[model samples]
Target: MPFTVLTILAALLVAAFLGYTMLRGRRSDEPTAAYDLRVYREQLAGVDRDLARGVIGQADAERVRTEISRRILAADTQMRGEKAQSGPSSVTSAVAVIAVALVLIGGAWLMYHRIGAAGFPDMPLSERLELAEELRVNRPSQAAAEEQTTPVQPPKLEESYAQLLQKLRDTVAQRPDDLQGHILLAQHETNAGNFKAGYEAQRRVIELSGSEASAEAYSNLAEMMILAAGGYVSPEAEEALRQALERSPDLGPARYYWGQMLAQTGRPDIAYRVWLDTLRSAPAGAPWADAIRSQMDDLAFRAGVFNPPQLPVASPGPTQEDMEAASELTAEERQDMIRGMVNQLSDRLATEGGSPEEWARLIAALGVLGDKERAIGIRDEALSVFAGNDNALQMIAAAAQQAGIAQ
Candidate 1:
């Protein structure tokens, strides 16, 4: 980019210099030449001094003096005729230089501005000019922007998921009992939504990390296990949730999801109470805040506590037992389960009775069933039901990949 910019600048400079030289050449050929008066007067004085000092013969000095006088008289006549033209021409040249500079600078700025093509496709022409002018006028503001824009240092390569996983696996393979390695593995697995792997890892973390670290690991494992349960509302999910809550009652996500599980299992009143506790105790803007709010509204509507929002209702997610069972299934069995899920989802879509959450559940079920094309079609229709969300996009992509379906 820098080389291209320099090449462009060199071209413009050459053009300007050529234009200035052509103009000067045209002026130089004029019959009425512009001469400096001081140099003419100095030459006349030098002739007079030479004549007085007898450095030159009087006749020779006199002849030279006559020629000089004639040239001075002719110059005075020309200056009188061209004074108005000279002043205006000088001003015009100066204005031309200024104008050319502005044009060159403006063109350069526009070209450079286009370098940010990846991010700002919708920039308007007026906005581009305004930004360029602002940047030129404020050096300090420009400096601040430059500092802000410097590329962020890349995170340590060793900490990356792939590298860390390899290291953890190697350590576990050698020791087969390293708890820290297990804890790292569990965290990675949970993040990747492999809850069974996470559960195994968390067990190792508990063994190696002692009671305090074990408590945290257990909480982490419990949350993921609940997600994998697949809405069956199992006893294991409930027990894990209870243990996690006992360890850290203020964990907002656990509280919110636990309340959701309760609502699913014919305990709306209990769920409503739990959500109320969550709202009061959980920090505002915490990760689970939205879930808590939505769940609260759902439970309240179910218990006839208040009118609900116009948003569509959704079915609860899988239970821990369901996830554990699914994880143990052979690949063929898993495919069968996915196909069954897709059929069920198709029926639900035909009925169109499920709320937005139910529709999302249906979408995910289709992806899991290896019906990427159909899943995307359903997703398009169901998108209006749920507001746009980053997590929703990621989940769809993940499910599609797992089912060996191209997104």
Candidate 2:
């Protein structure tokens, strides 16, 4: 009722203001023509004074006097013409003011009826956060239950590979307490695109690891679940990600996925902050870094944060000709070339104590080459070098963890 009263009062104030502006008589302190003529007369007197004082030549003073007199005559004529024309009729002015007030009020009403949430109650921040929390608790369970009842078609695979997978599954079941076996099975299933099975296997790995489970284990489980749900970050997945963050606050995958959850939940401002912070702290070439970088600017703008300048499109990597030339090389030659490049990068970093991003790339490369020992060594060296820089250390550690290096 108070709001309605206030709104009506505001409308009345606007109408009154507009009506007065339209009906008010134009009362100039002095008429425009009269003001101009007075200025011109003053100029003529100044020219006469200048001539008397011998400050100007007589010819120059006469020229200035003539110009001033001509302006005075023009002003006098204009003032007479203005006086002859009558002002707007009082009735006409009243009609115009009324028409304008009605239009403004009626137009505002029409626009509000068309586009405004006329009947909706205000949703304050506290209420919104409560609703979000409720959804977080209830939605995932419902989704998981529905998933269990729904039949899923498994991807086709070679008979031998399928047999091998079944054997691994059987081995994990027999040795339910074997954490390493569950972890291996989970990884293998994920690699084969069997995310549903991988999700189950990863859950078992988390259970077996118990209190020893690191953020990476929980994050991996969350990722598998997301994959199983066709990339939907269900509440269950969100819960797992939350746990991951609780264990390791800067876990890259968890932070990235948490941002995704925030965005999906219609909290763009929070999501923008999360993704931006993650991007700032993330190592270059980290698994999640590129995705976060590509999306952050758009999210920031949507969240009413500053609009970022458009970044130039990056050049495409490794042209067709270059790929073809590389393809022509023997497997051994390619391996040797890659190893050489990796070695050079390692040497440079060791000598120069390069960026955390560079150190992350070196660790990832070693992992890819099946040199977990070397990757671990590099991770340790990077941690020591960046000991005082917590953000850098976190980025490198997360990258190494993602790359399967023992931390």
Measured by TM-score, the strongest candidate is 2
Score candidate 2 by TM-score against the native: 0.51
State in Å the error of residue 122, model 1.
Answer: 62
lDDT of 1: 0.63
Candidate 2: clashing residue pairs, number:
0
CA displacement after TM-score superposition, residue 211 of candidate 1 (Å): 3.8
Candidate 2 segments whose C-alpha is farther than 4 A from its true place: 1-19, 25-117, 122-132, 138-194, 228-232, 262-277, 294-407
Model 2, span 1-407: residue lDDT tens: 54434455667679889878766654333556888888898888888888899999989987888888888899999998876653576788788777877876776666766876676666788997887777656565525743754445666889999899889889988998898898899998998888877888899888878899889999998888877776668888888999999999998899999998887776778888888777666653466868877787778876888965443332223334556877899998877767877887888787766778889888988888888888898899888888899899888887798779754
**TM-scores of the candidates in the order shown:** 0.35, 0.51
- Per-residue lDDT tens digits for candidate 1, residues 1-407, read 45546646875786588558646854453335345455577788999898889899988988988888888888887776665454336567667766776677676666666764433346565875566445434423222432444333333444577677677767787986776677678777666656556677776776676666633455566665554453333455556667778888877766776777666555576778777766765543456766677556657987667854443223334445557888999999978876775576568666755555555666667765556788777766655444476665555445445545534
In candidate 1, the residue pairs with backbone N, CA or C atoms under 3 Å apart (3 or more residues apart, or in different chains) clash, namely 229-318, 229-319, 229-320, 230-318, 230-319, 231-317, 231-318, 231-319, 314-358
Candidate lDDT (C-alpha), each:
0.63, 0.79
